[model samples]
Target chain A: MPNRNRLHGEEGRAYWSMVLPAFSIYLLVMAFPIVLSIVLSVSNYSGGKMFGGEPWGFAGLKSYARVFSDPLFWNALKNNFYIVLLSVFGQLPLGFIFAYIIYRRLVKWPGFWQGVLYVPNIISVIVVGLLWQTIFSPNGPIAEVMNDLARAGFQSRLEALFASVGGFNVDDGLVSKILDMAGPAALDWFSDPVPELKELILSYEGAPLSELIGDLCNLFVPRWSPEFLSKPNIAMLPVLFVILWMYTGMYLILFLANMQKIDSQVIEAARIDGASEGQVMRYVILPALSGTIVNSAILAISGSLSSFSLIFAMTGGGPSRVTEILSIYMYNNAFLGRPNLPLANAISLVMVVISFILIGLTKMAEKRYGGKEE
Target chain B: MSDEIKTTALGRIGGAAAKAAAYAMMLLFTAMTLYPIFWLIMNSFKSTREFQVSQLAFPKEPTLSNYVEAWKMGDFGLLFPNSLIYTIGATVGIVFVSLLAGFAFAKIASRATKPIYNGFVIGILITAQSLMIPLFLEVNLLGIYNTRFAVLLVYIGTGLPIGVYLATEYIKAIPSALIESARIDGASFWRIFAKIIVPMSMPVAVTLSILNISNIWNEFALINILVSRTELKSLPLGIYKFSGSLSTDYGKQFAALTIGMVPMLLFYIVFRKQITRGVAAGAVKG
Candidate 1:
């Protein structure tokens, strides 16, 4: 028998031929760069020939210091944190509930539900980002709906004011009285009281309050501005919602597949025992899915840490860099105007460290709270 | 007996309520997921002026003008082919390399197998963002920057870790006795692989292709960093530029988006089963 441990001729050649193609590429692209990234993060190489003699020195944590000191980095990190929370807290639970619904056959056409829900995930992240960006833009559907509602509220308020005033044509004195009560915005509409008035009323949807009655009526209208993409404070809100929307489908499918592996007979036996549906979910299904849930959390945390494409396409980290995540920050640093390679490398290393720490915490949490491992 | 009857009645009511809640949740989420895409397609058929007049209203005159204009202005004619080339090239490379390596790791008893396999597996966590800087330098050093070859190399390289890991796990299940018998018959390793392993590994090969196709097709960061030439830009980059240069024309923007989206959606519909199973398997196993 040929010695299996030590391949002599053909066997060794075959192994080398098969392994070298992938291994060399991995080493060249991933493994080598990862190590190089760590080293370059500490070096003072800002740009220019990387290995050639062009202003290369040991920066020694300077890049990291710069990253920490930049308030933009903090904002970016904060945005990523919100996304992580959304993924774990928002998407996972919603996905779980959706999966459970489908798994238990609680809804009709479960396959249709499953297929439709997962559609967003399979589409390109950039496309989904652009689609949501349009939906939240000033001229988009949400804005249209909000504008319509505000206009409707304004029309009703105008009707009430006219009813109280006895008529629309009540001389200049009555118009002044109406202006005093409804604020200055009422002046334009009260003057024409015709085709132009409709446009005038729509334009004054967020008109300032002048008196108690205006304030009371304005509370019902609640001025709707759909300029979210440019607003620094809340730009990430739409991004977060989109993240929740695009990714929940993936986790749903993941959970559904894991749930399918659980024998239906076990669930049947539980049901036959006098356990209610809730009880079955708690005792049998939840316990069975604890491992999958933990795994999904790890995926979520890691994914959250590295979120780029969607946000990059959606906001391009705009509105004074409010929507930037670490990845985008790192990307802009590396590729955008005046590349800062060292700082970009440092940011990436920081991302790696954070991902590991978060993933490690998840695994630890799983060990503690997750019922006996399957 | 009366209490038992009352409890049963309560249980029945609770079950019905739960079912109703389930249906509501499903309907609400599905609508949220689909409505935007539907809205996008509907508006893509309208002129920019019509869209501005009533954003939510159905197009009074659905025209193909937006689509024709977008197709011309976005240069989707060029970008679509570029995307396909990179996606297919990288996916094919990953699968071929992974299958070969997986067979070696599984059937061949080597001291180098464990460490090499472990090395590839570590790449599962090494995201593209982390490696972007060094890879840019490496691609430049290799003298293939701004070339499709560079993009393919990076995609196949970055995608290898998971591909190799999945391939190895799948191939390990195939009986070694088959390979041993083939070897005893004086058949060459390549011959045996061609005859036995290649056919046996089809399921994994399909899964690897699907996973990589979707990933590399939609990949933006690498293509953005590696390729600067306009001719080489993929659909994502094309659409991104369109979003900027044509920001005012919502009709063309929607049409560009529709052009980018429809092919993949069609692919999903056709391969609905394999794609989902492939995606679920890829995620769970990886």
Candidate 2:
């Protein structure tokens, strides 16, 4: 018995020795930082200084208040939710469809298609962002194509107007109101710093705001509709489009892997039961893929919530602070907000809470669905 | 019999239609994914003047000068090595440390196993967004701020939970007989792990390494927040130089982005199997 106890003790010691490094690293990098963030969020930690200065006085709930009132923060959250909605509604179904097509041998080159589809996932996000920017830049190929397609009379007229007044700042309330009256497309009808735009904006000699608005909105706005990342709602469409493009392939690969796990005989049996292909998909395939679909949804939700690099690279959260997601918002506060580290910390804490809530909600949905399916 | 024959004909027609749709989707998705990348490479060869004049047209006279210019702008010759040091060093650390800990949790029947393993599991769910401010503070506190070591340490830390979890799950599948028999032969724990566990757990250790490498290689956020010095910049940050307000070098920007991308793209192409497996394995175990 004593020998056995000694052996057990030795085993315990060995286990501790092995586990110690991992636990220590996790504590330092993950746990400690999280605790520090929570503490800093509540404290009077001003600027980026968390240490080596005057002790920060405790400020209760003020940072939270700042996050609540910030319109940009709300906008960022709404944009993030938009991406989430797209991921769930747009990317997942499309991914699953691709998987079903490939895995079911409806296509001959399954492996080739798989490889081709996944190419986007490997490219650096900065590169991807640059690629799209190249495609849609002010003088990019798309805009040039659109320019060719547009009416020549309208283009020359807009150019002359822009040259006469210089480029207009739509930020002026009166100009914006007037542009709205003319129609959305009239707002940015045609402009990219050529002799025309440079002459227009730079040459402006303070004419009545209405004439500028009328000339700009009624003529130019509609012309630059494909100028992605130009306005908030418009910018979101492209950003969301890219998000869908990049991730659908990943989820497709995932769904394919999961589909491979389901026995072929089960699918064959459904087919033999006089089930149409659609019926087979609805009954057998959907149920089998549900777990993976749920898992993918979880990943998508968490991923969408934390999306930063791609959007940041593409838009820098701008063309008017429209593309700022929660992660980018927090980054701006922490790193770029200049001495606003406390508010950044608060924003990060809010981000974490939201992540947990969303993840929990998905798991609950899965549970409810799983129970019904069973 | 006549009704059955009619239904069969309809079924065949429907199947053919579905197959055609599948072919169309496959072509569309591939084009959607690859076309932009192809365009980036194509335009990298064009001069900015040529790009402006005929952006869609193939370059009449392709130039390597854009690459030379982009290389200088990004200082990528310096940044590539920095990225290598972080990714390789972190990959080694993650695989090694995870092997040790995962081995303990999987092989040892001790009371500490459940809680210690659970600790790593909890570690996986902590998002980097939440950790940004405090992690910045903590790295500074550790006095490793702005150094490559700071990035490396954080990479290993973030990579460990998933690494250990995967290794643990993979190791759990190995029958106790091999490990127990090794123990009964009076082998030391280190020898057993190094020889028996390491070789037997080869596939998973590999998966972990690849995943870690890809992650550390492509990582932008942590390094972006952590490092400020131009020389210490990783490959992803190299593209930022082309984005200045006065950035007029469009040809060079595309070329620089291509330079930044090509190495990773080559790695992915060469090890497509390993990478695909690595990603799927990680996702499955998650």
Error of 2 at A142 (Å): 1.5
lDDT of 1 by residue, A109-203 (tens): 98899999999987888888888888888878888898778766666665677567654343455444444545655543356533343343345
lDDT of 1 by residue, B83-150 (tens): 99999999999999999999999888888998999878756766777667778887886778899999
Q: Tell me the TM-score of each prediction against the true structure.
A: 0.90, 0.85
Regions of candidate 2 where Cα sits further than 4 Å from its true position: A1-9, A48-52, A151-225, A358-374, B1-7
- Encode model 2's per-residue lDDT on A295-315: one tens digit a residue: 777777678765688888888
- Please give the clash total of every predicted structure, in order: 0, 15
State the C-alpha lDDT per candidate: 0.81, 0.77
**What is the Å distance of residue A231 in model 2 from its true position?**
1.4
I-RMSD for candidate 2 = 3.7
Considering the two chains of model 2, state its CAPRI-style docking category: acceptable
Listed for every candidate in order, the interface RMSD values in angstroms are 3.1, 3.7
